[model samples]
Target: MEERKARTVCCIGDVHGYISKLQSLWSNLESCIPRLDFDSALIIFLGDYCDRGPDTRLVIDFLVSLPFRYPRQKHVFLSGNHDFAFAAFLGAIPQPQDGSEFREGWKEYEMSEEREGWYREEGYQGMHLQGRRWAGKITVRFNTIKGTEYQGSIYDAEPTFKSYGVPHGSSDLLRAVPEEHKKFLTDLVWVHEEDNVCIETSDGVKTGRLIAVHAGLQKGKKVEEQLSSLKAKDTRIPKVEALSGRKSVWDIPEELTEPPTIVVSGHHGKLHIDGLRLIIDEGGGLENNPVAAIILPGLKIVRDTDPLVKQ
Candidate 1:
């Protein structure tokens, strides 16, 4: 019996609206991998597709065109914290099944509303907390942690508004965003699971289940419960921990250890690979950093600034 070739799987990190970097990285991936393999590869995009950079509109357009451009390739788009807020502001998130108002979820973060300048414009009455925050104006101009000047809001979402031809905090953004872009945001998944995924290791090639989320799964929680909440897109919770958590979600859940699942994510703003766990967000949406991607089986790392392709 002829042995089947292992399929190529590429997991791309946070783009944060840098169209040029994304284009360069895509070209580099093409140049580095064989054409036949690249065409049929499974491409998983770890989100944060909007904000921070100036080309969000173009970036979304590029992502939307991928399926048509590369018909043979399979693509999976996961929602990141930034993207979740973006979708919230666009009213793209599905309403809670319980029928509670989105504003009801704002109680926990209400204290920060005044300081963050949460959006209270024309259509803010029923807005989600993250949506208001995303479109809000912050009094402070600098971010101590990121060491970058605030781009109109704490989410640094001013660039996203500008990319759509609207001024920051303006309700005009409600209409400025295109329908296709809105659909793309609405369709983003919070969690993606793949069975029998092949990955390279020091020992050898191994096949196992793969779980891809934005930030990561919390370490101590029940994997099934967390997966349920994410799959339901429960907007009742003020914040989706898996998409925005920091240290809490840095490790894989103990439950998946028995079966040896590969957990991958891209929201930590750094590249880390340990055993079957991978964190691929090397760019962190900073102007100076380059976007990154990880090719499975071979476990090869590719960056936008690699200079692998000819100019």
Candidate 2:
């Protein structure tokens, strides 16, 4: 048997679609960690690679090229809610197990479809709820404390569609996105687990298991059941709570009493560092914020705008 070496896990939060910010963040990560460790690091991107910003296409390109560029580093590309919707729009999402067509998931959300302004363009009649939702128009307005209007919908996926040279809600996006990029989107995992990882806490440094998902595990659901569904990539079930729910996924499930898994996520659009649960999405799909990451062992944070980079 091969002995496994301790890996430096670098968990990156949501990178909406800002390639420049991602590039700068990558540079900062490289600068902070030793070159050898960085080269062999286990990089976990906490999903949401598409939507909200410019250059979604470029962001996917960069993610797809990482394995080839850094052969030794292990990369985990998780499927964020946005990426899932993007994949659904391209007809790349996995099918439901009940032999139901992808369109079945759209029925429940149909009443809101008109209100949400779901994509009714070419081939949309056969798409999933997430696909339509991904391309839907904004039904409500968002404003910052300064009263500046946030320039997108709840999904904020228009930029993603436009980034691929297709208008929002257009089936032309099916061909607009490159094949490899589509594969990347389709291959994203719903959950990732790493055992024997070192975690930093007030108690002391200890080795524990870690789980990374886009949003989080549903509070009342069983961990194994949730893991089983996620592992199977079940799409038949309408409304994946892990991908979209907020308050429901906020608390860790009480049933996981065995080894106590440390859960981390990013879709909340906020940076929350709670005891064992860490939500690191600081960008919040905003134009002014920087992409962020939390390095393992010490849980040291490094952002795109880290002082090391003279930005």
Candidate 1, backbone clash total:
0
Q: Write the per-residue lDDT of candidate 2 for residues 1-311, one digit (tens) a residue.
A: 11234468999999999999898999899999988999989999999998878999999899998999999999998998888888887888877878888777777777887657777777787778888777777666654442445334457777887898877666777888899998898899999998877777676666778889999998777788999998888998768888877999987787753556778899887888877788989997788987899988778889998879432
List TM-scores for all candidates, in order: 0.97, 0.92
Give the distance in Å from residue 233's predicted Cα in candidate 2 to where it truly belongs: 1.0
Q: Report the CA-based lDDT of candidate 1 relative to the real structure.
A: 0.92
Candidate 1 local lDDT, 1-311, one digit each (tens): 11235679999999999999999999999999999999999999998999999999999999999999999999999999999999999899998889999999899888898889999998789888899999999988889998889999988999999999999999999899999999999999999998768887776787888999999999878899999999989988879899999999998888888878999999999999998889999999999999999998888999999979643
Query: Residue 213 in candidate 2 has what lDDT?
Result: 91
Runs of candidate 2 with Cα error greater than 4 angstroms are 1-6, 139-153, 309-311
Candidate-wise lDDT, in order:
0.92, 0.83
Q: Against the correct fold, how does model 1 do in TM-score? A: 0.97
- Using lDDT, give the best candidate's number: 1
Q: What is the lDDT, from 0 to 100, of the residue 66 in candidate 2? A: 92
* Top candidate (TM-score): 1
